[model samples]
Target: MLNDIVKNLLKEVSGIAEIPANAAFNIRNNSKSEGRHSTENIDIVPKEGGSGLDIYVKPFTKNENVHIPALITQDGVSEVVYNDFHIGEGAEIEIIAGCGIHNCGCDDSVHEGIHRFFLGKNSKVVYIEKHIGEGDGSGKRIINPQTHVEAEENAYIEMDTVQLKGVDSTKRVSSAKLGPGATIVIKEKIMTHGHQTAETSFDVSLDGAGSSAKLISRSVARDFSRQLFRSKIIGNTDCYGHSECDAIIMDNGVVAAEPEIIANHVDASLVHEAAIGKIAGDQLVKLMTLGLTEKEAEAQIINGFLK
Candidate 1:
């Protein structure tokens, strides 16, 4: 059974309002395991070092979903967890993960999560993660996340990451190495406001022939907030890579985008795009002409852009 706070945090992060009785899941709260379940084709086992869990997906498994979410409810608590995923050959799965923090005391609450994925040949996986913070206290909410991926030949992986709201400070990093014929796609969205700061870094190495990678990020900064985005793609063989960053700034906010691409082979191809600006006047005017207020129009535009 989950308490009200844990339930709410679970819902906000992973959209799991009620725990599924027949699905694979591991819910961690304040560095402790709240609940766990394992399916026939998927297994979730705690690590021997007491750090995190090792999730295994059997070969040829399909249409399976796994949820691993963490929450921090008490103030002045800090923890680091390491979770690893072993994806078997020919398996296709979806993993849902996120973290939420609720602090009401005069001390900072922090959680750092490290995730690594090892993909077998011809496997495919989609991973989604979201972060949020909530409270009325004077303390800060801090979260740092790191992800590493190793994809074998013909494997494919897609990562979707979002920072929803109320995070005071965050630094996110992700890196990947791809084998022959492998591919990876990453999409990230973030919103920062009220003196908050957010930073994101991504590095991908196309180590084999026919490997490809694409990275796209969109962000909104408002009310004195600051954001920075850095992306690097290195092609060691004949491969393709692309990176893009688009941002909107408002009300004294600041945003920076740095992109780097390196082609070590003659057949390697790479491209990068970055754009940072405020909301367009014509967009606001069109929405206002349709019976919307200025604030409402701005909110709608931001929502659409992030989506």
Candidate 2:
């Protein structure tokens, strides 16, 4: 049933084009099946080599939701890879990827995914990723994703991410070099409730002159949850880079944000900024005086802070 749903979703996105050929593709499940609602129940493995897969992925036409639960374990070293070729000038692509998990049982899950783009000169791409989990399941999940983007001169790439409510999640990320006169923008928003913990990090660099990079991040934590975000932008030669982080805290919640910007050349320019705070009590009180209940006022304050 999950496979059918994914295939239908992919078909809706594929539109009139023929399904890309799948070659040298494999899937393995070795762990005991966790309770229902596992992501491992549904998996789509892309072939090693593919053609006609260079087209852009537009944003979802409307709101979409995907929920699943699964337990996957790897005894020895294992890996998963995806490779694609995209060659187009003055093109644009927007993708929205999201997932929700209710339980993972006891088995640990590891996901290592890669995306490669052969962008043409003056092209633009925007990618958004979201992850959410629920319940009191006690299992570990690790996600390591690498994106290699070859942006030609005057090209642009924008990446955004949002992670909400997880028990124990760790994400490791990587990115490639940007071409001359290219620009890269990154924005992230994360929220955690309950006793969950999450750690995520990203590393990006501008390898060509006249390139520019920017990162903006916001995190909110409640209950006993802990969240950490580490981001770095490096400017080489005559490039420019800037990064900023903002966080909100509540009910013994803890959050740490680290933004690092480095300039390796005399002509390079870099900047880093970060802020951490809690919802203003006076603001909440003022709202409560306006006929709103305490719960409503607190929710409004948090919504405003995240915005």
Candidate 3:
């Protein structure tokens, strides 16, 4: 079953699913919420509706490399999880959250997650999330993720999201507000194939002096897949913001990259850049001449490009 597959993979990726754990983990198995455990200084409370979790970290606590895995496996099942996080001041933490979906039923399966984070002053938070979908079923496996972040003074927030393969469709949206001397960085990587489609939108506001944000996205569309990347960053104070979108399109695939920057203050600065193109023939030929097969060369190029 997908539960077993995902559990094993999660263990390999994050080291452990449970047992001797320091941080908390909540696993959603085919619309069913499973056990969750946490450390002493951390609080993990299940929401009233059983579809979400409320998490709080004590001030001055350092929680590093915390693994929280959520898995969804079932045909025709639709599961939604809401995670509300409040990180205390002077605390540094890392979170690993990934979703694996396996659908073998004729009906389409979907998972939509909403996550919100509140960063306290002088704190640093790193969040890593990965989504994977796989099955032999005729139905589509879909995942859509939405995130919101509010960073206080001197706070740092870094978000990494990756969608490797097998998802039929996705629409992702993320927004953040940065306070004075706060920094927010977002990195996204996605790959789509086989008639799939994906769209992503990011909105960021640097509202305080010395606040800054960077939004970067990399995607590959192949075999009739389509994708759209859009980001709009606004600087309202003496801040700096930048957004970049890059994509490699192949095999009749289509992609659109749109980046916009808005500066409201004279001292504020913003920059935007986007690029979408197919794989370079010369690069592929050179790799192939080095004793690599065409397919191997293509794979190597994509792996390096995404990395």
- Highest TM-score: give the candidate number: 1
**What is the clash tally of candidate 2?**
7
Which lDDT tens digits does candidate 2 get at residues 1-51?
Answer: 224333333233222122233311112222221111211211232343421
If ranked by lDDT, best first, what sequence of candidates would result?
1, 3, 2
- Model 3 CA RMSD to the hidden true structure, in angstroms: 1.9
For model 1, how many clashes? 0
Model 1 CA deviation exceeding 4 Å by range:
none
Runs of candidate 2 with Cα error greater than 4 angstroms are 1-45, 48-87, 104-106, 135-144
Candidate with maximal lDDT: 1
lDDT of each: 0.95, 0.58, 0.85
lDDT of 1 by residue, 1-307 (tens): 7888888989999999878789999998888888899999999999976589999999999999999998998889898899999999999999999999988888999999999999999999999999999988888889999999999999999999999699999999999999999999999999999999999999999998999999999999999999999999999999999999999999999999989999999999999999999999999999999999999999999999999
Each prediction's TM-score against the native? Answer: 0.98, 0.71, 0.95
**Structure candidate 2, residue pairs in collision:** 37-68, 37-69, 38-68, 38-69, 38-70, 39-69, 39-70
Candidate 3 to truth, TM: 0.95
Query: How large an RMSD does model 2 have?
Result: 8.0
